[model samples]
Target: MSSQSLEQRLLRAWYGKAAWLWLLRPLSALYCRVAARRRHAYLSGERDQWQPPVPLIVVGNITVGGTGKTPMVLWLIEFLRAQGYRVGVISRGYGAKPPHFPWMVSATDDPAVCGDEPSLLVRRCGVPLVIDPDRPAAARHLLASADVDLIISDDGLQHYALGRTVELVMLDHERGLGNARCLPEGPLREPAERLESVDLVVRNGAPGDSSNGFSMQLLPQTLINLATGERIAAVRWPGPRQVTAMAGIGNPQRFFRTLESLAFTFDTRIFPDHAHYDASILESLPGDRPVLMTEKDAVKCAGLAQVNWWYLSVEAHLSETFEAALLNLLSVPHSEKIEQE
Candidate 1:
């Protein structure tokens, strides 16, 4: 089966009580067992853990699909930077194969080589950013190269090799652990119980447990014309005009919902997570109507975009209590911040 079709089937099994979901339960159990064993290996020191000289914070999710990790990561980075701590970031660069183990990603780095999310994060982040399959190696490289006081690992909660000081797991409000099962049976990398171990659980919307950790709101910012780099208000595109929305992120439904909220109507074409788009494929879409995509997808579609292509940019707004709660939760003193060169 094609990757996109298979992903759809798995998503259905995860959210719905389908008969096929039951058949996948055994494999899910095996997946959990292996995951538990690996985690135990790291916790028990059976596997060597690389600790950074500075504090390393990880922003990730227990759920399998997109739970707004990217937005949260940017929020945390901004929060940390405002507090005067020199920060850096690292990502696994999924779907990208670089020439080396530790690849330093720059603002101008090719999205096709560094992966869409990593490239987007690097562009938004002024801090040192590195991408590698081995996250520990990337972290080590960042620490050695930059005089950063803290490090943030994007989307690697299951990667226990890089010793983390704090774990901030992001959860979607509506789909919080769909069916509450792991992997093939449901949409979780770790089980629901894993939330108990995380330092903080951030809800991306109002429909989640506020008492568990804290709530975060993703505020939709203006849309950027991918073809010409012009900013436009999201609401401006919604008269009787309809556009085609394209997203290749982990959760395309979230993008569609955002558009709906803005009073925009569009036909959706959701590709698999981190899927690339070529100019020819984009050319097939209606040229008369604008094409909207996520910032992640915009990175991959940079040179491939036509005049009507645009991408929505979002900013994560943390709850008032979350900022103070995070500071208290980590027990880090702002006085200890070292200004990096």
Candidate 2:
């Protein structure tokens, strides 16, 4: 009926039916050509690079949204911290209201100001998270004050100007670069073949054995109270019930399926990636029902303190071999890393 409704319907249908959209590749290639020219000019010294003090590892996807980058970033942060590396995070602060310039995220900062994802990261992870359009600038600010050693961008695979050391590309096992095309043509930010060029490829969930890249499994559904930090055993919510589950995430159906698998029946409401939720939308849902959402949305729904909500936290389990390989890459001398790149 409307543009928003059309987008929602597409998302609901596209994940399982990628081949139908693959026909758009010719147009996607054309868009890539124009984008590549701009990228080449910038890389060839015709444009200035925004460099950060510390090495940056970009966790991103070719598709527009929901390849599980946030969980992957969370995994990396925890893994690096376990390895004794001081780390800070930076995000572009997508979908903030009254969009402000680079600012450090605090519990007090409105999600309307710093964005939902950045605010969630700051609150849940307890790491210094800065919101800025220029990721390099935000990374610099965090590095200068926090004494951090490395920077992990939430998503910046295409933001090549902010120089990075290693790039980890994430793919949704179910969606696998829908139509394998670029914006307006399909869903890819770059061609599917670009996966071969990245340092590492991560497929979230069981991508099925194809004798290909490494795989990371997402932990089963679990609930964490947004306010109390208390965990409710997932089994506590028995199904065939009318709970209200809201997801304003990159892919809402993935979350809906997750809730279903956990036996929590829902009247599902799917919002666009980074959708800003106001009072009215939250108020429209069944008020008496238990409300649930992805961790990303919980950050934005902070003001809905009156509503009972739990964040379904997903944990990433990267293989030991992948970890070892990544460590080896990181261990290489900077000179060697540059040479390898």
Candidate 3:
């Protein structure tokens, strides 16, 4: 089976109770034991941790699948910039294979080499970002090169070797912990109790367990035509359009649902998270149909401009109360923030 199909199957097993849930329990027990031990090793000082010179914010999810971490990171970056804080971003580039350990990403960099998300961030925010498996090392590189006052580790909550100043855990409200088992048995990377320790819990979509934290949502802004560079409102576009909605990210169905919410009628094409696209994939889709996609997919499809392609752009907006609370948690002086900028 193709990797995409395999993951879909795995997600099914991980998401809900099934026969396989019982089958995987033994392995899950072992996995959870190892996970707990590994975390304790770092927490107890058996393993050395690296701390960034500046305050570090971690944008991560405890669940296996995505919980809108990218949008939250983008929103955080924009919010920090508006607050006059110089921010840098670091991430473990999954699909990237750079010759060196720490690779600096630029707007013109190829997504195939630097990973799709990093390329998208460069194109979207134009901030200084580094991709390395050792996230703390990446942050160090960014600090050495730029005058950034703080760093954001895109998604490294489980990576205990990297010490963090603030931790914000993002969760998909629709899938809240998914059977609450770790690894092969279910979707969680760590126990569900891990949520209690994070500084803030960011829930995407409808009402969830919001007793302690707040909710955030992605507002679709506009769709950009990759071919002509034209912009159209996602909801206000006038057309009984036959388009192909494509997404090659974690939770492909989320993109489809968002498009449906915007009243777009289109066939769905879901690819594995971070799947590399080639000419063959484009050929498989119907001809002459406008293709709608997430901005992350657009970065990979930048060269495959053979079809009429457009990608949705979304702005993540947080509650005003949450905004004030987050700023207070960071506790940086307003005058210092302005001076850093």
Summarize candidate 2's per-residue lDDT along 1-341 as a digit string, tens digits: 11245666665545545556666657767888877776677668787777675678888877776788888888888899999999899898886653455788887788888888778777768888887888778787787768789889989888877877788888888777665557556766776777877888888875442445668887755677766767866767443356778888777778888878886777877777778788877767665867788888888776674536677887888778889978887777656776766
Clashing pairs in 1: none
Candidate 3: minimum summed lDDT over ten consecutive residues — where?
332-341
lDDT of 1 by residue, 1-341 (tens): 12365786677667765666777889999989988899989978999887777788899988877789999888888999899888899999898877776988878878878778878887877668888878888988888888898889998889999887788988878777788888878888887888888778888876434686677777789889887899977767543458888888777888888888997888878788878788766666787888888998888888888878888999988766778877775565323322210
Query: Mind sharing the TM-score for model 3?
Result: 0.93
Using lDDT as the measure, which candidate wins? 3
RMSD of each: 4.2, 2.9, 4.1
Better of 2 and 3 by TM-score: 3
In model 2, which regions exceed 4 Å deviation?
Answer: 1-6, 10-27, 97-100, 207-211, 226-230, 236-241
Please write out the lDDT profile of model 3 over residues 1-341, one tens digit for every residue. 12366777677667765665878889989988998899989978999988766788999988877689999999999999999899999999888987786999988888988998888887899989999998878988888888899889999999999987788999888877878888888888888888887888988884533685578788899988887888988877765577888888888888888888888788788888898899987678666677888999889988887537889999887888888878886897534643543
Best first by TM-score, ranked: 3, 1, 2
lDDT of 2 at 107: 73
**Best by TM-score, which number?**
3
In candidate 3, position 311 carries an lDDT of 90
